[model samples]
Target: MDIESLAPVVDSILEAAETRGGGGDRLSVSPHSFPDAVEAAAADGRVPVIAEIKPTSPTTTGERTEDSVVLAEQMVEGGATALSVLTEPSHFGGSPEALDRVREAVEVPVLRKDFILREEQLDTVAADMVLLIARFLNDLDRMVDAARERGFQVLVETHTATEVEAAIEAGADIVGVNNRDLTKLEVDLETFEEVAPTVPEDVLLVAESGIGSQRDVERMQAAGADALLVGSAIMDGDVTANTRRLVTTEGHDT
Candidate 1:
């Protein structure tokens, strides 16, 4: 979008990621920890599933749930590889306590899902990964190094080809191409089609937003996405059924 203004966001996020991830090689998970989700989706049987916690967007901050920790538990028990806690207060009704509660409930990697504008918030948490949009920052390498140094996985969310290239060049291993256009509040399946194939085969692609049905996951999988990060839809539906729908689009009873 607006590179000049957004560069700061990216730069600041990278600074935090590097300070945390430390100067280490890419991290891997034991396949034994994952359920059917990551195990089945693994390429030649590898890569962990990034099970993200569905968070309330800041725009809809007032419409919040009373017990997000329970939801996190359900997601893990229902078969998620990791947990993502939304900690942004302005848009998502997420709090540090919710993240801590979920982290205590499960033994999986928990990611802090916030705007991630600064490093202080990250320093105060015990998360294993951080989420950042590629289009919002300028110093991608610095941010990624920061996260990797902390032993925290960095998920670079991209919305366009330029961002994807920038992310990869900056040493990003996992990238998410969001189908939701924040400005217009719309879903363009074309976004998946356009960005998925171009990504380096090694970089895991995660399809986010506008996924209301299993067919969306199927479509993304076909387009080469390794996993799907969904929210709202599952929260808006019967918990178990929705979990089943996302975990296995093939109608397997969960």
Candidate 2:
């Protein structure tokens, strides 16, 4: 998505940051590691699924009103390796408190999923990992460094091959390819498949967005995705069952 389309959202986040005074004094260090969880799951011969706690999204049909902590616990029961909690309040219907609740309720590493524009925003993030969009930031490397300094692992997100290169050049240890083209709000599974080959083998690869079923999970695995970050699909109906289906889906060996 053009960063301009999210101007209002970014502005709101900045306003909130200013109110919070940009410090992590209230936050405690997370003992969990996001990439380690993914690697452990893959080593155990299961699909590494980073199930998301998304209440609503601009592209979804409706909102989920379930308790965020409850959803997070259920996802862990269903074999989710890690959890991605949306903290973008305006369009995504999420809040930082929800992320904190989920993090406390589950043992898995929690990823802060939001349109993070400024490094100051990272100061109060309690999540174990953070999502930084390669296409959104003018200096991905600086943001990555800032996140690392805060002791949070980074998942650099990209939508194309060029962005994938930018992520690597920015020193991203884990890279996620999002299938949805933010500008059009349209999704195509081929987006990840097309970009997967361009990612180096040593760097962890995560397939994000547009994954809704066992078949879709398999397709991503076959295309060399080390992990799958699923959102709306699992949040639509039964969180536990939906997460179970995707995590247990049979797929080619990575």
- Which candidate has the highest lDDT of all? 2
Q: What do the candidate models score in CA lDDT, each in turn? A: 0.65, 0.84
The residue pairs found clashing in candidate 2 are none
Model 2 lDDT at residue 64: 89
How do the residues 1-254 of candidate 1 rate in per-residue lDDT, one tens digit apiece? 24453344344544444454221334332212223345554532322335455565522333536487788777766665666788655345676677778877777667777655443434545566678677656766777876666566778898889888999998988888989765555678779889888899978678877766666766777888877777676666455456556666445331
Angstrom error of the Cα, residue 72, model 1: value is 0.9
Error of 2 at 100 (Å): 0.9
Tens-digit per-residue lDDT, 1-254, candidate 2: 23555445445554554454344453445448777898788787778999999998767778889899999999999899999999877668888899988888888889999877778778755889999999778889999998888788899999999999999999998999999876666799999999999999999999999998888888999999999999988998899988888887564223
Residue 198 CA error for candidate 2 (Å)? 1.0
Which ten residues in a row are the worst by lDDT in model 1?
27-36
lDDT of 1 at 120: 41
Q: After superposing candidate 2, which stretches have Cα over 4 Å from the reference?
A: 1-28, 250-254
Q: Assess every candidate by TM-score.
A: 0.78, 0.89
Clashes of 1: 20
